[model samples]
Target: MTMTIGILTENVGVVGRFLACQLGIEYINTQPLINARPFKVAIAGSSHV
Candidate 1:
């Protein structure tokens, strides 16, 4: 059996890693696609408005 879980957050530094460790899962940092790009776009858009 195979299972997958994904957790999305603005910042996944310490807390995210800790949770993944406790859950016995591998922590993969997909920050650019998951958090960074959108955040940057939002910030840029807000600044422009």
Candidate 2:
């Protein structure tokens, strides 16, 4: 059997990155790929309260 996993987050924190590293997975943004498909990253005015 084969399996795959994915983690999606707006902003990855220290713990998130650590987990990704421990799992040997890529922690990155999809901007580069989306750039070719008319997608973009949106910045918020402030962090959620």
Candidate 3:
């Protein structure tokens, strides 16, 4: 069986990782998802660009 979790927050650094660890699942951070996408301008702008 396979399941996925999605966590949205202003900042998920510690909390997200801890939950993923305790649940024995993978944690996807913002940077990897951002990097996998085509670069574009956000309405609020980005530090990456």
Candidate 4:
């Protein structure tokens, strides 16, 4: 098994890149996807507020 890390944030900026570089991991920007699909997110087994 391999270990990996992914960073997801609303804004993609230098901070994300810097963290990825320092940690040697991948940084994903969710802004585009959010823009394409605006939906409500609820945690599993939890009631929506």
Clashes of each: 0, 0, 0, 0
When sorted by lDDT, best at the front, the candidate numbers are: 1, 3, 4, 2
lDDT tens per residue, model 1, 1-49: 0112233334465655554465554655466467544443443444356
Q: lDDT of all predictions, in order shown? A: 0.46, 0.32, 0.38, 0.34
Which tens-of-lDDT digit does each residue in 1-49 have in candidate 3? 1222232222355664564455554555567456222221221123223
Candidate number of the best lDDT: 1
lDDT of 3: 0.38
Candidate 1 lDDT trough over 10 residues, lowest sum? 1-10
lDDT for 5 (candidate 3): 27
Sorting all predicted structures by TM-score, with the top scorer first, yields: 1, 3, 2, 4
**What is the C-alpha lDDT profile of model 4 across 1-49, one tens digit per residue?**
0112222222335554454455444444356455322211211112222
- Window of ten residues with lowest summed lDDT in model 2: 39-48
Give the TM-score of each candidate: 0.36, 0.32, 0.34, 0.30
Please give the lDDT score for candidate 2: 0.32
Off by over 4 Å in 2: 1-12, 29-49
Model 4: residues >4 Å from true position, as ranges? 1-12, 28-49
**Model 2 lDDT at residue 44:** 17
Clashing pairs in 3: none
RMSD in order of candidates: 12.9, 13.1, 11.9, 10.6
Top TM-score: which candidate number? 1
